[model samples]
Target chain A: MVKALVFDAYGTLFDVHSVREKCNEWFPEQGEAISQTWREKQLNYFFLRQLMERYEPFDQVTREALRYACKANDVTLRDEAEEELMEAYLNLDLFEEVEEVLSQLNDKKLVVFSNGSPVMIDPLIDRSDISGYIDDVLSADGVKQYKPVPAAYYYAQQELGIEKEDILFMSSNPWDISGAASFGFRTAWINRNGLPKEELDIQPEVEYENLKGLLEWRD
Target chain B: MVKALVFDAYGTLFDVHSVREKCNEWFPEQGEAISQTWREKQLNYFFLRQLMERYEPFDQVTREALRYACKANDVTLRDEAEEELMEAYLNLDLFEEVEEVLSQLNDKKLVVFSNGSPVMIDPLIDRSDISGYIDDVLSADGVKQYKPVPAAYYYAQQELGIEKEDILFMSSNPWDISGAASFGFRTAWINRNGLPKEELDIQPEVEYENLKGLLEWRD
Candidate 1:
């Protein structure tokens, strides 16, 4: 029954925390703490900016959050190291199953509904060499708002000329699943780490251990 | 140019984490963890719910977040103790300068713009015995949205018949100050713990260590 399959980019297909290795190489012993703080701050700023009605592009949010995280951890983020980390983000390795799963999809019009800015996500998807498999890429900047804002999902619906129920929205993050489902889409969650579902009372139609497991979806 | 004053209730006027003692008592060695997780989850649910377009009243948010936090910390939350902790929330102690500062206000209409439900905020204000000092208590439920939502702030402006520039919004949270300022109100941050300013590019018109220092605002 699903017409279009929409994927969340960060942490679903892209491994965001992979930057920790480069961070470790640069910051030495405190790399993990800084990287952890950076990720947390990055997500926190998205929520904060959305609530405040001040929309910052994902690139700016990432950079500013890194600055704050570095300051918090007493790490001196020199210009080169800062560039190195951000450049590393654009090349985050896909999970082992991502390319294989995309190749196995049988004629579903696949697309990405991402919070990343076009300039950031487009290059990453291209560099990952999986751009050929996806039908289109959608970004929150199309409406100047991020998920799980209803309008963000609505943008995808209007663009594809499909009903919400006709789209299968998937995310590894529990909150994204709840949001897309709450907005009336058929959602499947990739619960890779097997974390407990969020307490929001919303559940996805299917749960998968990894991208490869998505091959089992029938509709 | 300021015509009236609006105060953010939590963490500014009332100490929300004061219920930690009860949490500690019930959870034993995990009291601090339970309390910290509870507070984090509570704020997180606010953003998640807001983004998901699922609104829960502040009191309900508190209960649900507390429940999740207890589960995460591996604490058995019996009904009796759960009620005890939630009830204690409604009786949180006000900072020492709250009443004195409210009392010292000259002629500006004093009001609270809070995320709390009336049931929660009213009793807390009453039990703190500071009901006489304030003019009115406005809850987010009145607008069906919570703080940092521009609509939530604009509701106060419309209710009080004041221009945005004429209302001085004060919140201890740097993010709240940024939001209020971006929404066109003059803001003062009660930086109680001397936290650094957020990187959001909006600065409060004034910063103070406590409510009494609000007396320093000349406008």
Candidate 2:
């Protein structure tokens, strides 16, 4: 029986692209491109850092990614403009279905396990309507290891005090799902984009279009 | 004084994007986009596999990356087309200055250290005119650890029988340079495109526009 539902916070529950509006305000006609590049570079930075054994908090990674994205899109990002964009991450829009689904799954332990640092994630959760529905927030920062590295998932499992098979891990990112599944968790891929599954050898046990799919889970 | 020069083959010596012409033949206007995505996903798969302890040869990773890139660009890749594209990797065009530079730096041990499987890399080197100039070829497959991961670099160092500081690692890819730098090898960022540097904390010891800059390095 599953004892807890651990969801990846960024793309799974919070809309990472919500910052596009603020980005647009700073750079006309380039918001969407900047946001897309920023998100891709952000994850790329994480993977590179993890492989290089260079761990930085997610906030720093996000900022560096933004800088690269701006350069790539041929836009200049000033200090104040960068700060505003960074603040936008703290107030990211939660996916529309997140609150209702978390409320329904309140009987189960609902935790946010993410690469996001607590400084960013805590405020994100505290500001959201589903804050009360979440039982815990775990950051990869705590272990100084990012996802897909076994240590990060193992840290979450230890913190939850549950066996890996008794925890259902959900992530909107295919790579995250692959990582969790490889780590032996019962994974649910919250593939919101309706994209094809990644070619990684590991497969998630279940696939969901959104959090509401979690309601179908028994025990 | 540098005892040997280690190079990253894909982007550093071989122009990975040179396959664009073949890709264009198959996908027309979408060739550049497909090639870019294919290269990005190829490296991503390597990092993810390394982090997840799921090791696959570079040939398989390259093929899988092509499949995703084709799907992403909305192109149908027949088995024969796939074979052609995969074949293109083995015969990638060497950067214009690679042969001249390698011929000039013949005094030092010139090694190709890469994540590429020997199956692909060996033939690639054998087909290049610079083959006579290269001293040794070391692959991540030898250790089942990809670059940016310290173990991979250490494997190359062990195979070369040289100290880290005495080796000058060169790569057109910033992440590879960063990884080699972090591994304690002196690094040169072959910024062939004159792109901005990545924000990773580690920095290469030198920056050059292309392989020709290696000519200035003296023991």
Q: Which candidate gets the maximum lDDT versus the true structure? A: 2
- For each candidate, what's the DockQ? 0.56, 0.67
Least well predicted 10-residue stretch by lDDT in candidate 1 chain B: B193-202
What clash count does candidate 2 reach?
A: 0
Instruction: Summarize candidate 2's per-residue lDDT along B17-128 as a digit string, tens digits.
Output: 9999999999999889999999989988988999998889999999999999999888999999999999999999998988888888887889999899999999999999
Per-candidate local distance difference test: 0.85, 0.92
Query: CA shift at B109, candidate 2, in angstroms?
Result: 1.9
Task: Give TM per candidate.
Answer: 0.92, 0.95
- Candidate that would win on DockQ: 2
Q: Model 2 Cα displacement at B169 (Å)? A: 0.8
